[model samples]
Target chain A: MPMNAQKSVLGTLGSRAWITTVWAVTIFFVINLLALIATVMTSSFGTRWLGTWLPAGWTVNWYASAWEEFQLGDLLTTTFEVVFAVVFLAGLIGIPAAYALARREFTGKRIVMLLFLLPLLVPPVTYGIPLATVLYKTGLGGTMSGVILANLVPALPFVILVMVPFVEQIDPRVEDAARVFGANTFRLFVHVLLPLLLPGALAALLLVLVRTIAMFELTFLTAGPDSQTLVVALYYAVFAAGVRAIQSIDAMAVVYMLTTLVWLLVALRFVNPTQMVTRAKRP
Target chain B: MSDTARNHHLPLKMRLSAAGFDGVTLLVLPAILLLVGFFVYPFFYGLWLSFHPKDGSVFGNYKTFFSDPFLYETISKTLWLSIPVTILNMATAVPIALRVRLMKNQRLLTTILVLPITLGTVLVAEGMLNYLGPQGWFNRTLITFGLISAPLKLVHNYTGVFLSLVITGFPFTFLLVLSYLTGIDPTLEKAAATLGAGPISRFRHILLPLLVPGLAVTFCLGFVQAFSVFPSAVLLGAPSGPTRVITIAAYEAAFEQYDYSLASAIAMIMGVVLLAIIGAVLAARSLFYRGPAGGGKG
Candidate 1:
């Protein structure tokens, strides 16, 4: 019961506990990495062990087949179109509105912002059915425009949220100074505010792009055969049909994962994620 | 004299036009209009539909939903699973966020977590099938480790569904919490420790209070999100047992049975329940994080 003896016992147990937790977390992450590696390797490696451990042989046949048979070029292009349209147009619309909200005193700003995010908070299963009804009524269902508009549920809110911080950061004095000099508000936005906000805008673009491409539930409910995205394709290819139907998904999963990873990398180039998320309060 | 002539020469209408009538009505009008037409209108339509059936002759779908014992079970079932899942998600995610925040290159780890968010419910459902199916690696490992005599029945059941929801949902909850946690200045914790406070004391007295607001928001976000899940219910949840969520049934009634009225009723019930919960959570958030800005980042 001496202090030193008690301290030594506690130290031993503490170190052991720390080691166990660290190893467990390390193993947890390693499992994720292995899943990624196994995905790539299994494309060519074939089945090995209990079909549990790894692939047996190796070939580029799957990738070549996916490209040729899946019509990936068209899928990629279509997805890119919808994704860019949602991200860009939403920004085109959302940035100025968000700036207006942040800068000028407005009536019902909270309610308006809430309206923008309603699509996100509402259960998609419920609204999706009704929206589909509206789309069908308007002859917009199962079309590119439908997908673009449907995807707006996530993208508009994101752009608005991103811009709030950007607008907050830029000093109002700059715009006011332009106004005093007889420079109109339009000139102030174009000349003073717009250039300074490119980074936040780029960040918003990338985030929106990511959301638009990966958008599943709405797209599935709304997409035409023509508008099927990579995520949707990958879903069918894996669960609904495997190699015989569309070949192994390993290649496409690789492609899909890589495409997102690349975009995230590029987005980080312009905007810091931490900063974007936290920038609202720092001012 | 020249300035006076310039002012006199300018058309008053053009100068007035420069004043800008309404940025709100102009700039945000697209999204605002879309929300009204699509979002707000649907709720009313849903409310109306819930009150009346979509048959050639109108009837009350809401009465049927509330009256029928069989259909009403889904409401209770969703509550049971959603509450547990929200608590479970926060339990798993908060620690993950804490640990992840303490590290460098967090965005990279975040992107990895977030890739699944992009994958959507369909891909996550498929991935769950791969990992949790009858011939899945989880059961396969169990057999290999001698933890079981044979591969266990993990899929087509609640275990499979719950696990899938966690994996799919963790990234989102983690991102929200991580963003919240990063905003707290770490120096406060250091200051707490310097005063001879133990780790538990520091977290309890200093950390948890500051975290309450963030924790409250994340909790509500997780709750609403978990409660309304669909694809997982369709793909992995217990088909007949307790895990069949209200949304899946609503989808069936709406799309498969073509019973829009019933679907609308179910959707309304789900929305009302969710809004109530969100309102409650936000109230708690406002109570605690009432700084000068309220600093309620949401």
Candidate 2:
């Protein structure tokens, strides 16, 4: 009753609650950012920010060490290679499938989408292990081909997910017009359908690239010694790299997170991330 | 033409449709085959491995997984970790997402929130450790505050793993849920208010029902994503105590221990359980969509 009595000028508990919630959220953001800043500063300065609220000085000691000595260059190249291959392959496969679902009527149209989602729904552990086993036993385990194959399971699904809407958004009659004019399926796709879907395809490519680049779980489990990814390398640095030395995981964390953040920003900018598909209206 | 004659024409169209489909299928066959061969086969095979054993019998591996308290802890711990992390992610992402979608400045706010989606799980886990781990900033701050006598233990613990999961998972939920929110027609809410419905009523009657399907979908997607999470679990999760997840056990079995049968079994269990839940949710959403406003298409 007293608390209710304390309802001030607005005569609304909801506003009060919302205000409190917003402030609470803001506090969360501040704390998280502060923590992140703290990590970066500590790694950069090799010192705490207690007395002055910020570090007195900064150093590039870790960056120099990471860039110069660490095999980050090689790992980065491998990461790029795998991500590029997966994106290209997924687009080629995804475009045709998406065009079909969009253009034609089929007996089991609904099930096709479900089938597309199958790879995504299946647990990573289930496939990653067997794939790793097959690759290793077959001598492709640590090879680029092996990593690229493993990456496809997830990347391709992501491609299909983004591509479906793109396919759906193209004017249905355009393809029909092409068909009437004697354009076969391949020409229609190559000229008419492809141009319309290309934006969506590009969006899908960006989406998959973001997902593939940042993904560590599958890469970690399936990657072989020579094929070890950047994330995997980062993993060893924390656990197997002698925790006491190696200039603190803080520096390494900054490097990994910052790089990922930059790439994601680029991806999100190109793609209308909210819609998940270019030119797609709400269904 | 009679209805049967019309239906006869429909079959022709359907048959003709196969040509188009075949082309599409041919293109996507590699991915589809890969999914079937790698994911589906392994899934059933993993299940088979659980029951049929390589060492001696099928039940033996599952018995090891279930009977041994250690193996069992992985499952329970994984559930525990997943529940909280999923809850935290949905809680933060959904409401902010709701508000963001309703606001004019959606892009700017969304850009900030979605930044973490770029950062991989390993990077996030590593970042959390660097920030929260012993000898990290938080401890240094506490020391400065005289709050603790020594640097606090943070990394390689439940707290570290949970925090990392929250950071990584929240952005995804926020982005997806926000998109779902944007799709709902705003005029309905305006009409509700015009007809004497309060904001809460508009939300409950109009918004909540619409949000139901999205909520269920987002929840399942987020939960499974969290459940299958690996990098953070290995990097930040306490291997022995406060944060060991089932994925870790499966990894160790498959890779470290060279026990494919056992690994497959564990993997199978995970796949089945996850699929079962997703399947159940999809079925529920489909049934609920019997009305005209069911989802437009897959």
Candidate 3:
């Protein structure tokens, strides 16, 4: 028994060593990545940072420069317009369909599900070109309408996918009870089902809003001068074949980061990232 | 109308209200129409566009794609970049995820890790341009620490884009592996221990078999995401040499050169490569595990 206990103690010590080593490495890696991001964030505010541990001085002028140079006021307003339209329209159409999918059985259900999966599975650029082509051919290209329409491709499907699980979790008997009280289909959706599904819908739509805002490829392909979202504009700011101050560009990047970070934090508050991952993989 | 007719109408209305095929179709049709119009139609159109050039030959665009050495180079280039990035991500993520899975601060760590993903790739690329530039802090810090005499040329090259991919790809890969690891029943490892399997043997015999499929899947997802590199390559990479990936080629062909058919052909090639990798991974998954993997039961 003494010998066995000694072996177990050695084994535990070995395991502890391995764990500590790996934990140290993880912390190192995470800090390095975060430090890189932090450098960018801090440098954006620095008036002129040189070879040093920290910037010699800090200023808000870069943010002002980025705002003026990037035409951020117009860009942000356009972004909000597109994001709101996408969220509202996707929710308007997707929630009822999710309720139908959850409650009603239908033929070709698997095929419908596959149709939804393709957009999420395939990379957006693979299809963005043709989608952009079609929009241009139809003369909807280079317009806000075109951007919103292109974004809807992914947002609508995503809403349906996310909402289906939420709808499935609801007790159908409550909905049926409303139906039994002589509520119409639309009324049941509005009065009873809507309240129950609000949390899920809110979570799903917030995510959709975030996705649409960050959806670069589709938006990049379809956006015109007037319709560029914050992300695409950031890309152009860097790659538009002109000289610009690095700090100014970094400021723009920070704005983009903060915009996405705000929405993601809100979405995370409602549905944690792990829950989002599991929910995404549910189908 | 008599009382009996009115009563019959109530049953018919109730049946419709319960949402049969017609009602369900009405509810679902708008979504179906939107997807078909925007998603499905565009894909077929892109495929069809690849086959029809102005010269009116179905094989012309593909022939041009294959014949041009500059355009053809991108295919191999994309594969080279993505494979290494994917492998590096998996290699780095496995150890970290394994550690994080057991840590009490997992949620906080994960949130910090996932912050980059929300920033979007373009912003990350822009940040990289500042953070990894010749005079950037990365080099400055290294120089300050007496680690190197000269600043490394990080951005506007393959090394720069590779670093960006790692920064963005690692979190996704880690998250996926961590999720899959949780699905593995801890009792399995404990059971192996009871049979006198040490940590190494227990991991090799039990955990490794379960982890392989998940790793392969992580690789596939990571590869695909990395494979579709455009904005990063343009922003942080040379875009004409070592880092001019296939998507960049396709984008230039379509948008820059106005050769839509050639662009479509390149896109098709890109799609084919991605699918082949995914299929290969999934096939290997079946070979490793005979039973259902996780299947949400573990």
Candidate 4:
């Protein structure tokens, strides 16, 4: 249908009430969300902000205090280490598995696919307790490696799920042609598949990076003092709130928000957020 | 025997490949092993731990959890918080997604909406404390506009937790519904319009049926996310009161009381409740039209 024709049809159908209500709801939600974030951002720089529309004074000292109080320098380094490790390891294990799952028809393929789905289906906290217990027994709990391993449970499956659709989209004939020209499996993947798969892999890993950064449950359950990610640290800071200044805490929040927002923006450039969910939903 | 000997003469890779474990297929092993070693094993371990209590018979933890109102009430508390929030998020998401699907600037709107999801529950909770607090901008503005005589008690209560869940969860629900709505071809609605069906009837007869399955899925996913409410419940909610959710109970059992067995039991119960709700929704989805939602060529 032509756009104007559809519009005429819609307009004549007297659906303006519905459209108006939707826009009202959406505007209401967006305005509140932005205001909430703006409140946090404004407070992070405010000198005093009690019972007032705006702060008495604005300063940047909270950032410095938050950095010192929260040990943010070390916290950021740990977060980056854990996030990168998860991204790297998930890619290494997940991409090839995705390729295989996408290309091949083998016995128990359904079962294999279900195995991947379960981790994503089950919330991390449901499993994180026992996993933490097991990690503690193995002397890995409260350690960086424990956090990394705990995170990979969801991250690896996410990578595989996201990459499967991407892998399936590749032309089989391309792989056949590579094989016909004397390419072995290794050579085929390296020379042909690698380049073709790069975009999808990067998108998947970038998403994994963003998810790992925000993954609080598993990281919180498994992390020790030194292994705590930024989100976990923020949770602790919030939970134990009396000692730290609210301004400094909001400053830490702004830092955390900026970190995730930067990565999310980068990720959105490569992938449509909605399409990613839809693709992952595919059987 | 002769076949086996001949097969044995080949490389191990080839031998394995003959049984359908080809080189490509074997790539899946590492991921499987990781899941097994981490996710699968731990789930069973938790289950097993739940059965064996530290101070009593095998069913001690379960008994304790059931008998204690404090522990058991968390179930109802959590369900009360999660179910309504999930329903509200999906209810709002459906209409908004329907609206956004027709708009020209869907991507920009979606990106803006998606900010909450990435900002996460903790940040949202933090912001809510300040934004919706007694002395915060929200109240000040409302009061300035003569909306209320006094600041409404929003944070550190059930209402605060509810707001936090909606703020963090609505984006996700919206995105999922939008994706599903977009997947349904616009021509279906157009066809209904051409046939002189009114807008409401066209939606009732066409879009509503197609959207049911997707709505069920959105409900389950959104419910799962909300049901696992942890940080928001603690930070934005009165954790010792109305928001003493199941996860908090489990955390207290494990960390505060140093009773891993009871915690594991609570975790297992949480999983079972979550799955049971999801299973019921999915089962109900079968009653609806289950064909391809899309009108386009696959």
Candidate 5:
């Protein structure tokens, strides 16, 4: 129906040809992505996928071996531990800052917002070196806390950026009404504002979780052997000086992708992923 | 000072009530402290470290980086790679984004396109190593269909890294353009159509002019992203060849050679180039900026 309208409106074969070309290219791109993913997923489970239409055999051994060799069970626990800590702290600190920035105008607010944006704007590796230097100098480096702190450089700002819009959506009169009803600041936050902010906070933290989980450069720079997240571990499993099975590495890749995909799916439920692209550009 | 002052204080408390600088500061201070302690301090520390080389000579690392051909060449090499990649990404993403916008399954399509992004660059590089490697499916299928007798050298080269960068970067560029495209008023196209303008004219006269600014912003952001090619450059590229971007140089300088000052200098160079490009783009964007109506949802 839309095409019919466009056809009449356009009334040109060249225009019709351009639309067809667009759809064709888009489909081709999508097919390539699916094929790439399918190839990796198949190799992870294939016993021998040696240059053929199908693998000669299949087994679950690669997954089991990857688990043992990469010690992914431990790495996964470390990932979750680091993710939860970063997410919780980001929400703890970022929500109030968002509330402040959203509700009240203050001197140097643009500068303050820019300061929050620096971490997200600059590449992590640019700052990771010196940040790790200080963390090491202060004796916090090579620990889970160090990794969490490094990730928080971006996560806190992200939470604040995400929450500002949510906070702005709420009317100020509700808070004024609560104040008039004899509520204190703390009580007003808990009783009146918390419920309204919950969904946004959840979405922000979930994005933070996904970001930190897939965050390679910061975690790689900061994490100790015991503190390594899954992506960092996967990086080592592939690049570190060792002879490892390709299938097992592929398995590890699948695991990391799934972990990130799960959170992304959850975050997508609450927030439009496309909005994140534009948000990063603006702030 | 008794009754009148007490009443004045009560009124002040009731009126302002956690809505002033004190309240904003109380809420914002923790985040500020964290940024200062982590982001600001480290950036300056890196700047400081860049000056004080291990040899105890000021500007020593900068001198070394400039003197060495391998290190110095990365400046041009990075530009060569990032510029084409950025241009190609925008070129392809524009039409694809426009098409995807009109689709009914827009969300699902975007979700699939964005899947690789969430997988992170490292995993994507790893996947490319396998899928694009010799004797991988790409080669096997070609040989099976008698397309080629010899397997192509796809991975462990410049081509491999370029492919990986495109895979990860294109989705982001596509999404950014799609959002900008959606924000354009459809009525303008309808108005042009009612005036008997063809689709080609409508696109050229109506859409193209409006999209130029958004496209410029997209190119700058996309260029910065592609310029910071780290994981893929290390994983997929021929490390010492045409793909020896500056980030690898910095990483090696810091970690391998354990030369902190040299690494910081290289990073500073990278940042300067990025900022210069972004500044230039923004400066150029303003020449074409059409105010509130042209730019969508700033």
Candidate 6:
């Protein structure tokens, strides 16, 4: 009896130690991450930063220079154009497909699901090479449309995957009720389904928007000099960092970070982050 | 009864609806068509392109890839970087997620963790270049505290790429694990405790078994993300040397060398390698218990 009691006390100490270790690691990670981000933020506005805990002087001139030198205004415009186009099209195409997958069972359903899952499962760079080849083959390569189309390969599927669960949560009997009330198929969709699906559709599209903005491999491969998005432009600035001011590049990095972060913040307000990956568990 | 009788007289849409190809079902076609055009077609086109290399006959690109040490070595190098990083991220995520699940401010913690993900690889790489640089705050703090005499070279090397992967990949792995952990009923753990199973035993006997399937998935997805590490590999690592991953090879082939066929071959190889890894993980997962891990609504 004494031994068993001693074992229990030891077990509690072990568990406590384990919990502390986990928290320590997590806090360490979080601190490092915050410091990393803070470094970039500070350097962006700093006049000189070399082997110091803090910069010699601070100024916002780098932001102005980065904006002008990188042509960020045009890049932001192009990015928004591509992102909005992809989001709008993905919603238009994906929501209806999600509704079908959720409400009805049919032949070849598994195959369809696999098709949607492939783009998400397969890394974009693996497929982006071939995709860029095909796009460049046709006249679409290096065009804004090409960027939008390449992005939609993943965005459409993502919307469908995220929305399918949302659609499934609505009872099928509700659709039947709408049908029995002398509603046509179009009317049933426009009036009855749209209202219920709006929140899900919004969540899905917002996510797609955030994803499109951040999607690098596809945009980097497919975009030309003229069609470069902000992320792609930022990549170029970093890649060819010898000529540009480091502070300016950091400023551009800050801009790119804020763009995606704002959308992600808004996205989190609508959808739980976990929902993004939950559909992966489905058979 | 009247509806059935009148169904035949209805339009082709109605007739198709009777066979389960309803208007709603047809809605899926546009998305399917898009995928077929962009994804399916490009994949096959790439395969076909791989067969017709620039210099030699069919299988030329594959032959070149295998024969050239520089080209072939990327597979191992990539696997070396990605596999370990994926494992580390998953391993770390499981414990942290388990703790976070029991926390009161789960959402806030999760949101903070997720910031790195939205920051994207390019920005993270850029940030790492500054923050982890010899002159950055990380080294400065260590030096100020007298932790080390000389500044560490954290960026522009393998350590740089590895650190960037953890920063970006950990949140994703954490989010997935947290979701899966939340799905398992807390009562099961309670039951285990009541049965005198210690916390470690409870986790090992109950949670680990339940989490294998989700872990397999998390690993694959995380592996895919880390495997195709491009921007960071280039911006943060010795891209031509240590971190010359398959994607980098493909990029160089297509863009730098302007060899589309070779690039296509490399891309195909990359895809195959990724699929093989994921397949193996899933297969191993089947060796574990595969049953409902949740209670209540699930």
Best by DockQ: 6
- Residue B281, candidate 1: alpha-carbon lDDT: 79
User: Whose lDDT is higher: candidate 3's or candidate 4's?
Assistant: 4
DockQ of each: 0.32, 0.47, 0.56, 0.69, 0.58, 0.76
Whole-model lDDT, model 4:
0.90
**Tens digits of lDDT, candidate 6, A130-221:** 99999999989999899999999999999999888888989989989998998998899899999999988888898788878989999999
Return the interface RMSD of model 3: 2.0
Least accurate stretch of 10 residues (summed lDDT) in model 1 chain A? A274-283
The CAPRI category of model 4 is medium
User: What CA RMSD would candidate 2 show?
Assistant: 4.5
lDDT of 2 by residue, A1-283 (tens): 7775775434477767885796589457647855764565465555444434456566667666666555677877887888889888888776676655665665665766687776675556657876676666677777878788788877777777777676777777887899999998789868987678766777678778777877676787678777776767777777665643445455656666666666676777666655432223344
Per-residue accuracy of model 1 over A177-230 as CA lDDT, tens digit each: 888999886787788887988777877778777666766667777787898888
Local distance difference test values of all predictions, in order: 0.70, 0.70, 0.84, 0.90, 0.84, 0.90
Candidate 2 residue spans exceeding 4 A from truth: A1-10, A30-34, A45-57, A179-190, A241-255, A275-283, B1-25, B139-153, B275-298
The digit string of per-residue lDDT tens for model 4 on B108-220 reads 88888888887789899999998898998889888989999899999999999999999988999999998888778888899889999976798899999999998998899
Over 4 Å off in model 6, which ranges? A1-5, A276-283, B1-15, B296-298
Report the lDDT tens digits of candidate 1 across residue range B15-97: 43344335434676776776677667756766776667765345567677778766788888888878887888787777667
Tell me the lDDT of model 1 at B261.
77
lDDT of model 4 at position A174: 98
Query: Model 5: how far is A34 from its true place, Å?
Result: 1.3
Number of the top-ranking candidate, with TM-score as the measure: 6
lDDT tens digits, residues B1-298, model 6? Answer: 6977788688987687666787678889999999999999999999999999988699899999999999999999999999999999998999999989998878777887778776689989998988888888888889989999999999888999999999999999999999988888899999889999977799899999999998999999999999999999999999999988888999999999999999999999998898899899999999999899975566
For candidate 1, give the lDDT of residue B2.
82
- Cα RMSD, model 4: 3.8
- Give the higher-TM-score candidate: 3 or 5: 5
